[model samples]
Target: MRHHVILRVIAKLGIPFIVLFALYVQFHGDFGPGGGFQAGVIFGAAFILYALIFGLDNALKVAPMNLVITFIAVGLLVFAGVGVARQVSRLRRARRQFRRRTASRHPARRARSRDHGRRGHDRDLLHLRGPGPVAVEFLIGHYNYWIFIFLMMLGFYVVVARGNLVKKIIGLNIFQASVFLLYISIGKVLGGTAPIIIDGGGPVTYSNPLPHVLILTAIVVGVATTALGLSLVIRINEAYGTIEEDEINDMDQEP
Candidate 1:
């Protein structure tokens, strides 16, 4: 790689742009078609590209193992924190509303509340909300789901059937990609635009932003997984002198 001066220069020129675009995709995800996963992949690819051009040693110098691990933990904690915060807030609001409603109720209702208690009222409220029917047309709209299924199966088969470590990693990536596609497809609303509100008279439809946001986090996790897998594969090759699963197995079995 060091011998290829032109390639190194081009990589140096291009890596910054790739990283910048990844940041844009990460930030613009709510208003556009990208999110964490896509951005993470792009960012990971930039580092991977840098590693290829400049060498893994230098790449590690930039993104040390401790730094990577810390960021991975931070990203996961942030995602989990958002979910926990939302849940806690919702519960508090629901409790406040319930107290207000119960307080405002008539004598008979108050008597029932005293008898049934807070738990009973909450249980009744949950039971009151029946399951909704699924529309056939709604299911039909997800033509991309079949693609997701197909890719998932292909990736699964590769992981299960292949002996090559690299091929298995590729299959794992494909499997992750299929799941990503499935989530994206599930979040899509036909004719829906970005989930942004405009100060216009026209009623606008916005796609669900949750899926994109979730996928971004998933993407970050995926990048971490990929890096970890590659590192393990490197270690395995160095130790066993082969990356094929069967070869490693045979070597392990030998005296």
Candidate 2:
């Protein structure tokens, strides 16, 4: 069969279920591995395929760039905003504790000194040290979520602020890459050996391995999504003679 003919058949037969399955995976992520990032790409791909078969205009009408951009930004912001909120809450709690400690004591100066001592101790508790593999692993796993948040913000800023289509795609890639880091970091185990088996009779502590496998799949998916997104950008530029989003919007509005 011709490529277009096959695409039409696939579009008719597969798009609906593909979308449904994407939603399933998205919601099911908390229980298992798959999550919003994977599901969004799959959902995006279904529409992208439709766009390829029917036309960009029709697909955009179905899922406008503005809406898709909103989806992307909202997902990232939810993730990062949670981290920022947590940090803020922690700081507030610390301040409250300081106030209570000072108020509980009769002598304010001694209370202040005691509060400062407690604050220093709290800082020390937060200070993560190396040397122990387990400690390092714990620190990395704990902090990876924050790193993911930062990366998401960076990616969203790039996508929203940049004019170049390629740069936007790069931002999208970075956003996806951050999630991959999160998954992989969580999978790490202290003193865990590599997945490969050694020839000699050596003891080995293996990591969960699931996160690594899942991340590998995610990386492949990310690459495919990025390629497809770039292709669409190229097509958009070809059809409209400009890839700058603002220019495209203006062109669409021109009567």
Measured by lDDT, the strongest candidate is: 1
Q: Model 2, 1-255: lDDT tens per residue?
A: 235777788787998998999999899988675487789879878987788887888889999899989987998899899999877778767878877876643242442343345444223434566568967775665676678889989998898889889899999998899988877766565676654444574545555566777788899799889989999998998999998888999999998
lDDT scores for all predictions?
A: 0.77, 0.76
TM-score of each: 0.61, 0.44
* Poorest stretch of ten by lDDT in candidate 2: 105-114
Candidate 1 overall lDDT versus native: 0.77
lDDT of 2 at 127: 54
Mark the regions of model 1 whose C-alpha exceeds 4 Å error after superposition.
15-47, 60-142
Residue 199, model 1: Cα distance from true site in angstroms: 3.0
Candidate 1 per-residue lDDT, tens place, 76-121, comes to 8998999998777787678788878767543334334443442543
